[model samples]
Target: MATGAESGRRLRVGLLGTGGVASKYAALYGEYPRSLLVALHDPFDPGAGELAARFGGRVAASVEDLIASDIDAVVISTPNPLHLAQASAALKAGRHVLLQKPMTVTLAQAEELERVAEDSGKVLALYMNSLDNPVFRDLRRMITEGVLGKVGSINCKLANGMGHVWRNRPANFWRGSRAAVGGGSFAMLACHYLNLAQWLLDQPIIRTTAIGTNLMCDHIEGDDLMSAIVEFAGGELGVIEAAWCVKGEQMSLHGSAGSFAYIDNSVVTMKADSPFIGEAIRYETPGTRVVLDGLLAPAMSDWTNPYNQHRCFVDAMLDGTPVPMPAGKGVQDMRVLDAAYRSSAGAVHVAVHVAIHVADDGAVAEAVA
Candidate 1:
């Protein structure tokens, strides 16, 4: 362990925003031995004192101060557009960063962040803990073990009812702001699944089609129901559907040789010729207990488990384990999202182009660092 003057057993960390997602990271930090919450920063929170009291962290008056602190990393859970600026600050500060998904509101910002991450030689990660999830791990293993041959098609579906939290509610709801929060519920809520489809399949989206609307929530300018169809380079296709208005959750996966799904986290339905889909098989593969409890549990619950992601960050930073989500993939998701947005507005399919860049020093970077 490094000394207290140098970090000891705990990696000092900071938070840029204390929203729903940030709270998940904070909760996770509480459980990880490799990290400690040293500072908290949220410009709009009136309950900073209470938050600081619970977390035993200093309340930063600004993001700049948080960056300047003695933290080795930061969990940036700020809103959409703010991600670009906040993440850039953390990276430039020479701290590793774990950013909320969708990297940034635009491809350009995501690309820029990727560059900075390489330049700084810091681990810039996306909170895409799902990639390290039990279901995906199991899925990947099954696919690798030849349980699902060829993966001809995968339909990735997600749905959740956002509830009527925006009706004259607390002052903290920024779901309706596009500039601050970026796209509506889809970008914030469902973009992860879009990313999951690509990552879990080990492919990028080649083409995409999207349709969404602002029908239900008048509180913000974002859409309530988000849907998309993407084709992968492997000649495989996937469909992603998410609705902020959906009351129950469901995910179904279909491959050439099998099919599986879980509904409301209660029932599991699967059919595979490879015999790995039976009652004897557990979704939590033997080696992934921490990931199962930390990332999968919280994601399965509406509340995502406390510190799996942060701990994952620590494992990567200290032990050099391969992290599930890299900063570059975050940028790729944003590119697909950008194509989806353009597809919706034009009522036509758009080609998805995720620009993968290599820095002058030969370090590879994604558009969103």
Candidate 2:
């Protein structure tokens, strides 16, 4: 495969949407050696020009204008509803895409996007900020290595004060529309941890039961406080609680032989048997602290440090490396979110209808069971 690097040229990039999440990723195009931000488009945000000024791109007149320009790829950070149309357009135009979280508002849209991506033969990577975390990598390693014997359950709580932000105002913003975001806290926030839990366990969540309500944020259309208990296909259980009305985070991974607990993904505490560790061990970042006989601590990663997720996307496009987070994985994520929403609506346990399958050629396929 011929690459931009091999041709002694950087891959020209385009950006859609200029919101907070877009800003978080836009800088990498200018910083990474193999990519350059050449065009940008955001109809609702006047700040698009400012983003282009800082990130070395020209703010295009429209999405069509941006995609029609001389760009090889696009980074889409728009609202949930916009995801399908924008991503579909880009893929049809033969441009690689890096899309924001909660891939789409509906499972149908996700499945459609997946089909388009597979047919287009272009890279469609999901931009998940949590995937950059080194902690989860270490945790996955420990679990896979049987350091934590027979993992049984994973409990997570992710909350924030977005309810307060929406309380004083009317339902004016895009986030205030359930038609746009799919759900409230669970869709916007809990989806991240849900994907993470399944990734760590290397299995699909077969069933979920959830309860959610618009407790304090009546201005928002969906749930402000939501909790769900998920059953993995491997029989491991997961407890998830997400709150837009509160502000805090906690995650615990329990195993028959040990357990790991942490808050805000920092200052983790680990407890194991005599062979693994004598007692509880707690520590923070910077240095590589040893846990057992060579297991290092989950040190913090500066995701903006030139070689982050965005760079990985560039490499995948130009160098034919594996996509960091594939579009099929995003479809599975949508299935989990869909199950949670269905379970909450029915007040009963709902089964995730989609299952993941790997092809003989190593491509991922969706099996609707």
Pick the lDDT winner: 2
Indicate the TM-score of model 2. Answer: 0.84
Tell me how far the alpha carbon of residue 166 in candidate 2 is from the true structure, in angstroms, after superposition.
1.3
**For residue 3, what is the lDDT in candidate 1?**
45
lDDT of 2 at 8: 61
Judge candidate 1 against the unseen true structure and give its global Cα lDDT, from 0 to 1.
Answer: 0.70
lDDT digits (tens) for residues 183-272 of candidate 2: 888999998888889888999889998889888887788888999999999999999999988899878898987787667755676765
Q: Provide the clash count, candidate 1.
A: 13
Q: Each model's TM-score?
A: 0.80, 0.84
Model 2's alpha-carbon lDDT is 0.81
Worst 10 residues of 1 by lDDT: 286-295
Residues forming the 10-long window of minimal summed lDDT in candidate 2: 292-301
Which one wins on TM-score? 2
Q: How accurate locally is residue 251 in candidate 2, as Cα lDDT from 0 to 100?
A: 82
